[model samples]
Every structure is written in structure tokens, then in C-alpha cells.
Target: MTIYLLRRLFLLGTVLLGLSIFAFSLGYLFPGDPLQNFSGLRYLDDSTREQLTLAYRLDGSYLQQYLAFIQRLWHGDWGLSLASQQPLLTEIRQVLPATLELTSYALLVSFFVGIPLGILAAIKPDGVIGKAISAIAITGYSLPIFWWGLLLIMVFAVGLGWFPSGGRLGVLYEIPPQTGFMLVDILLSDVSYRQAALQDALRHLLLPTLALATFPTTVMIRFVRDAMLDVWEQSYIKTAKAKGLSRLQVLYRHGLRNALLPVIRQIGLQFSTLITLAMLTEVIFSWPGIGRWLIDSIYQRNFPAIQAGLMIISVLVITVNMLTEILHTFFNPLARKR
Candidate 1:
């Protein structure tokens, strides 16, 4: 196990090295001068230009620039955001939790909800209940997330007024950030109308959560249903049934646990992707998450922010993938053997 983990760590380091190169090269590889794009200034005086060039190490060769970039990163310097002129890491810290909260809500909804529906579907795939779940899941999975978000906003937020269209909270609730998660922040703060603040947060959360979760929930339903069905066909499942075990007992005790090993892997795979995928939903809802932050940075041509975002997001995605792999290997005997 230790040897396997070490191998995985080496692989992770190799991938990070490659990703860093790709991220670092973007400034030079792209058409526009990064400084001009970031600075938004038509002309730069020689002294200012020289300073900027030195700061970003644009004056150096690619290898030298990359080494400087790594050195600065080693010292915990992620560069300054051109838009805010603050450390890029500091800006990320403010927004990343929002993305995590939003994505976490969506994941919870999908996991708990999808697994039961999947088991039900597996039990009676041809029945009306099963057919209904399958149809809804397929349709939800098929639709584009942005379009789905808009459709939801129209019906729930605009037409029906059941929920807020966008943002984290109503202007009435001035809850200061205790933790980045809005719900937790609401709970922790000594705001007036505290319960109301939380209710507003949920209302603001619903539409975006629904839109973001649709794809994953639907996918989970199909995946779980299929996995459970496959598990039920195994000889052990038949043996349990032959032993006169109740249908429910066999399904729960003998089937679900085995099915879940793969489910863990699937959900972990979805983890990083959902964060990046939230970009569209974030834009439509105007939620202040990493996705929206990155989008705004791009619009402002804040190349430093862009670069930081790329590197940060790359690390997150790669780290999640690596963890998923380790988790899968840990759970599956066949994988561990390989």
C-alpha cells in the first residue's frame, strides 16, 4: 500500500510539473501581451515597462521565466491580481468556499437521492416508477446546464417567484462572513432576523443547486441503477435469494454495499469537474464563486488572475483525480492487485 501511494505521489508530481509548464507558457503563447491585457493601458513608459517585465520575468527566456515562476510559487506568492492589485491567492480564498458550498450541496442532493431512486429503478426497471425516474434522469442529463439554469430561473425565480433569481442573500440580511459557506455564516452571525437570513440563503441556493445538480443526479441514477442490476446478477446474490433472504435484505445487505464501491469512484471523478462546470451556472445566477471570479478576470483581461486561476483549478482537478484513484484502489481488490 505504501509503495502504491508513493507511485501515485510521483505521478501526481509529474502531472503538476506538466500543468505548471502549460500554465506558465500561456502568457507567451497567447497573441496579446500579458502586461497590456492585464494593465489595460495603451502605453507603458520604459521604466514602468522594464519593471513590469522584470516582475513577471518576461525579460527572461522560457526556462528562466519558468524557474522564477516556480521560485515565487515556492515562497507562496501566486502573483497580484491586476484587477484588485491584491495577492491572487487572497482573492481566491474569498471566493473558493462559495464554489465548494454550491458544489457540495449539489453533490449531497445527487448522492442520497440518486442512490435510492437507482435501487428502486433496478428492482423494477419496466414499472411506471422506474420508467418515470429513467425518463427524468435521461432528460436532465441530456440538457445543457446553462439552458437548464435559465429555464429554472424563468419558472421558479421569475414566473412563479418561488426563489430568488441570483446572489447569495437578500440585501436585508447583512450577515458578515464567519465561514465562507453562506448557510454556516448565517448560523454563526448575530444578524437580525437570523432565521429569515438562512431562509433567504436557501431560497437563493435552490435554483442554482437544482440546475447544477441535475446532470450529476441524473448520471448517478443511471450509474447506480446499472451497477446494482449488475451486482444482483452475481452468483452470490442468487445464493442469498436461494437461502430465502427477504428481497429487501438481499438488495440492501448483499447488493448495495458492493455497488457503492464503484459509486464512490464515480462521485469522486465528478468532484473536480462539477467545480469547473459551475462556471455557466455561476454566470447565469451571478453568484460570487470561483467560476464567476475567473470569468470576470477573463473579461477584465487580468492575465495574472487568469494564470493563477488556471494553476489553482488545475491543482484541484488533478488532486481530486489522484485521490479518486487512490480511493478506488483502496476499495477494489481487483484494482489493488493490478
Candidate 2:
């Protein structure tokens, strides 16, 4: 197992290295001088602009710049964003947690809501409940998240006044920054602070969470339903039924357990995709996260920030894939044997 893990980790590293090169090169290849935007903002004379270019190591051969970028990466310096004039790592660190929190909440919502609905649908494949579940799943999957978020804000926040329209917390709430998660910070703080912060955080998170969760939840439900139906048809399920086990008992203990392996893999893949989706949702909602930050950087042609964001995302994707592979092996021992 250790050997397998190490081998996978090495492969992940290589893949990330290649991804970094590709992302960085693409950013570099964009038309126009990358320093053009900086020219207007910095108000530097020609000599000074040249000096700044040299300072940023931009006045170099493309290969040289690429090599230096990789060397700096090795030393943990992701370069400074020309727009923000901050270390790319610092910018990324500030926003990554928010995106992660959003994705985590979405995944939790998907699992809890989707899996049960799927199981129920499978158990009664032709019943009203199953038909309703299928209809909802299809609609949810077809709807765009941005549209869903806007509708949710309109109905829940604007129309009913049940939730906050946007932001991580209310301006009035005093949330201590612990681990960059508002809810966790609240829980760890004093009661007065905790109460106000928790309420604001939860209220603010509701719409975005629901919008982000919709597609994944729909996908999970469909996948789970299919898996359950497949497993239900297997001979072992028939044997369980022949032993006079109740339908519900057989469904839960035998059917659901075997059906979950595929769902688990799908969940892992969905999580990787969620990171990307969270960025889009964050922008629409004015939520502070890596996604919003990356979009801003892209518009400004801030290569460092873009590179850092893409690299971080690639790392997340690779990590999730590795985790899913391990989980697949664990659930299906024949995978390990092969």
C-alpha cells in the first residue's frame, strides 16, 4: 500500500509539473506586452519601466523566464501580482479557503440529500416518488448554477428576506479569523461573538451553498440510482431475497453498500469539478475565494496570480484523483491484485 501510494504521489508530482509548464506558457503566450497594464499604473519613465521589467525577470528569453519561474516555484516564491503588487501565494492563501468552504458545503449537501433520494428511487423504480426524483434530478442537472444562484437570491434573499444576498458575513458581525472559516472561528470564540458570527455566516452561506450543490446533488442522485438498480439485479441480491430478508433490509445492508463504491468515486471527481464551479459562483455572488481572485487576475493579465491559481487548482485535482484511486482500491480489492 505504501509503495502504491508513493508511486501515485510521484506520478501526481510529474503531472503537476507538466501542468504548471502548460499553464505558465499559455499565460505567457497571451497577446500584447504583459507589462502594458503596469505601464499606465506605475507612471515609470522608460528607464524605470525597463528596470522594473528586469527586476521581474521579464526582460529575458522565454526559456530563461520559464526556468527561473520553476526555480522560484521550488523556493516557494510564486512572484508578485502586478495588479495587486502582492505575493501570488499570499493572494491565493487569502481566497482558497473560501472556495474550499463553499465546495465542502456543497459536497456535504449533495451526499446527504442525493444518496437517500437515489436509494429511495431505486427501491421503487416505477413509483410516483421515483418519477418525481427523476424529474427533479433532470431539471437540477440541466439548470445553470449562475441562473440558479440569481433565482435563489431573488426568491430567498430579495423576495422573502430569509437569507443574505451575498458576502461571507454581515458587516456588523465581529468574527475572529480562525483558520479563515467564519463558522469555525465563531465556534471557537466567545459566546456573544460566536452567536452573531455563526448566524451571519450560515445566513450568508445558504443561497450560495444551494446553488453550488444543485448540479452535483442531481448527478449523484442519478448515479446512485443507476448503481443501486445494477446491484439490485445481481445474483447476490437474489440470494439475500431468497433468505427471506425484508426488502428494506436487503436494500440497505447489501444493495446500498455495494452500490456506494461507484458513488464514492463519482463524489471524488465531482469535488475536483466543484473547485472550478465554486470560482464562478463566487464571482456572481461577490464571494471572496480563489475563483474570484483568479478571474480578476486574468482580466489584469497578472501572470503570477493566474499561474499560482491554476497550479493550486491542478494540485487539488491531482490530490482528489489520487484519493479516489485509493478509495476505489480499498472498496474493490481486485483492483489492488491487478
Candidate 3:
């Protein structure tokens, strides 16, 4: 197990190295001035341009700039945003937790809700419940995320007025940012209307979470349903039934236990993708997350922010995939044996 983990860690390092190169090269690959934010302005003079270029090493050859950028990266310098004039790293620290919080809520809903629905779909494939479950799954899978998000906001937020249209908190609640997670920050806050704030936060959370979870929940259902069917026909499952185990035990204990390998794989695979999806969801909901922040930076042509965002997001996805493999090996002893 130790050897396996060490090998996996080494592979992870290699993958991150390759991804970092790609992330950095992506800016150069596209046609745009890295310093375009300062290109045409009466207030900006030649000496200022030279200093800015020198500071960013943008005046140097591509190879030198890349090397310098990497060297600065090693020293924990991510650079400043051309748009906000804030350190890109500082902005990432502020925004990443919000995204994580949003994604976490979506993932929880998907995992807990989808598994049982999936099992039911598999167990009673010909029944009314199974057909309904399949229809829901298909509907979820077919809907475009952006479209779904807008539909959700319009229906749930506008028509019903059941949830907030966008943003993480109501304007009335001024919870001091403690952890960057709204739900957590609300609790940590000592405001008089703390309970109201908490409720408001959850209300703000509901629509966006539902929109983000819809697709992944459907995916989880399909994965579990297929796995459950494959497990159902296994010899051990039949034997468990033959031994007079309760239907629930025979199905959940014997069937779900073995069938979970694929589901585990799906969980890991889905998480990395959820980040990408969260970007669009964040925009639609006007949530304060890295995704929306990146979108704004892109629109503003903030070179530093854009470059840093690419590197950070690429690393985050790769790291998630690596952690998924570690989880996969942990769950499936057969993988360790192999």
C-alpha cells in the first residue's frame, strides 16, 4: 500500500508538472497582448510601460519570461490583477472557498439523493417508480446547465419567490467573513439576527445548488443503476437471497456493497467536472466565486488574473483527479492487488 501510494504521488507530480506548462503556455498560444490593459491610455507614459514590462518580465523573450514567471511562482508570487489591482493569489483565497462551499452542497445532494433513486430504478426496472426515476434522470441529463439555471431562477425565484434570485446572502445580513464560506461565516458571526441570516443564506443557496446538482445527480443515478443490475446477477447476490436474507439486506448489503466500485469512480470523475459546471452556474446566480471572478477578469482583459486563474484551475482539477484515484484504490482492494 505504501509503495502504491508513493507511485501514485510520483505520477501526480509528473501530471501537475505537465499541466503547469500547458496552463502557462495557454496565454501565449492565444492571440492577445499580455499587457493590453495599459496599451492605449493618455495617463500611461513610456517609462511607466517599461517599468510595468520589466516587473512582469513581459519585455523579455518568451522563454525568459516563462522561466522568470516560474521562478517567481516557486517563491509564492502569483502576480497582481490588472483589473482589480489586487494580488491574484489574494483574490483566489477569497473566492475559492465560496466555490468549494457551493460545489460541496451540490455534491452532497447528488450523492445521497441519486444513490437510492438509482438502486430503485435498477431493482424495479419494470415498475412505475423505476420509469419515473429514469424519466427524471433523462430530463436532468438533457437540460443544458445555463438553460436549467435560468429556468430554475425564473421558476423558483421569480414565480414562486421561494428563493433568492442570486448572490450568497441577503443585503440585510452583514456577516463578517471568517472562513469565506457563507454558511460557516454566518455561524461565526455574532450578529443579533444570526438565525435569520443563516436561514437567508440557505435560501440563497437552494436554487443554485439544485441547478448545479441536477446533471451530476442524474449521472450518479445511471452509474449506480447499471452497477446494481450487474451486481444483482452475481452468484453471491443469488446466494444471499437463497439464504433467506431480507430483501433489503440482500439488495443493499450484498448488491450495493459490490456495485459501489463504479459509483466511487463516478464520484471522483464528477467532482472535477463540477468545478467547470460551477463556473456557468456561478455566473447565472451572481455568486461570489472564483468562476465569476474569472469571468469578470476575462471580460476586463486582466492578464495577470487570467493567467493565474488558468494555472490554479488546471491544478485544482488535476489534483482532484489524483485524489479520486487514491480514493478508488482505497475503496477497491482489487486495484491495490493489481
Q: How are the candidates ranked when ordered by TM-score, highest leading?
A: 1, 3, 2
On lDDT, who's better, 1 or 3? Answer: 1
What does candidate 2's lDDT look like per residue over 33-92, in tens digits? Answer: 555422223345788778757755687887766676677677777666778676777777
Q: What's the TM for model 1? A: 0.92
- TM-score against truth, every candidate: 0.92, 0.89, 0.90
* Residue pairs with backbone overlap in model 1: none
RMSD of 1: 2.2
Worst 10 residues of 1 by lDDT: 34-43
Report, for all candidates in order, the number of backbone clashes: 0, 0, 0
* Candidate 3 structure quality by residue, lDDT tens digits, 1-338: 89989998999889877776765675566455545432212244678778767865787787777777677778777766766666667899999998999999999999999998999999898899998999999999999999999999889989998998999998887988888999888888888999999999999999999999999999999888888888898899889989999989897687878888767677667888799999999999999999999999889867667777878888887787778788888888888899
Model 2 TM-score on a 0 to 1 scale: 0.89
Query: What local lDDT score does residue 312 receive in model 1, on the 0 to 100 scale?
Result: 83
Per-residue lDDT tens digits of candidate 1, residues 132-226? 99998898889998888899999988899999999999988788887799999888888679999898899999899988888888889999999
RMSD of 3: 2.8
